[model samples]
Target: HIVAAKYNIRYIISGGNFATEGILPKCWHYNAKDITYFKYIQKTFGNKKIKNFPLFGFLQEMYHKLVKKMKIIYLLNYIPYSKNEAMEILTNELDWRYYGGKHYESKYTGFIQSYYLFNKFAIDYRRATFASQICAGAVTRTQALKELEKPPYDESKAQLEKEYIAKKLGISLDEFEKIIHSPAKWYRHYPNNEKWLSFIYDTYRRLFKKEKLGNF
Candidate 1:
């Protein structure tokens, strides 16, 4: 945002509806790519440079959270398009090909979501997305639950994807597996002003009568 402001690039448009819409739509967006890159850097550099100091890490995390909240706010106030409607316009009017699954356009993201996140963390993001869709009246809760029962990706292609992602990231299969097996960590693990920030957020929400920020 600083850079955008410096360049006078106002009115940044984003396709952030799916974060709230609850449908696990195709993840062919800048934010998806940025997340994949962040993960790659974290694994490649071991987070020393990324985290450096507790205060730095805390500030970074807070900034990220703020940006995420801003995106949702932007969607609520300015951009009023739905995932289904956007896809229709893109496919029919712009002739955009549908990319299969969330973030499938990026092989790294495909591997991470389908194999890494699923196998290691047991994080099926589709569950959240499906719930969102249910809330939005785009899909039924029963249907979402049914879909959640299945594997995130094709079992037969799992090994192939793992190999592909490992090679692409210039990491050995064993190294990649090590990362997968490692415990998950969050920004709150670092010393930070999270409580103070939360207090401020809550205060602002109460003062403005705004809805509390949703979990990403």
Candidate 2:
């Protein structure tokens, strides 16, 4: 209680009931993920014995369902890049590793904020591009021609890229354009700031609200 209280947690759920009685603990981190705290959780509850309660896995399953149901209104793309050549490979493969393995790594350093919201951001990106394309296309012929002839990734090319990305996400091009865009949806608000720590804290705030953090 003291430890949890120090972290401003409201209550502590024990794992003895889960392991011994076949109950499962709630996925509290569904609202937020804190590495140092969950490290403590792994230390404390990771080794508890499992029993045969039918509801043991209920909490996590329910949490997943809730997550799928909640609409993600905002999205931001915080693509990390650098002029340094050696960092390119790392940035290139980041998306794959993020959605797959190394997901838990985000919790450790709060580095996964972009990654965690990326699945949604990708969908939004396609949509926003679609809208931008339509707006750009409806312009005068001269402007349209100019857009078409623009650089390697100009408006037209970007539009096609958006369509391709939408297809990859299994969302129609129309769905992409109709959604809203807000600054809140952006993941990389201040990239030039300190060592990504400010972004991490902002992502945390977005995930759990400005009120408080949860207990493990």
Give the number of the best model, judged by TM-score: 1
Q: Write the per-residue lDDT of candidate 2 for residues 31-145, one digit (tens) a residue.
A: 2233333344445535543343222132333343344332222111122212133235656866433322212343322222222233333321222222333443423445535
**Alpha-carbon local distance difference test for all models:** 0.62, 0.35
The CA lDDT at 210 in model 2 is 61
C-alpha RMSD by candidate, in order: 6.8, 20.0
How far does residue 129 in candidate 2 sit from its true spot (Å)?
22
Candidate 2 residues lying further than 4 Å off, grouped into runs, are: 1-82, 85-153, 180-216
lDDT of 2 at 27: 26
lDDT of 1 by residue, 98-194 (tens): 8778788887787777777777767777876777777777778888788888888988888788888889778899998888889875444433444
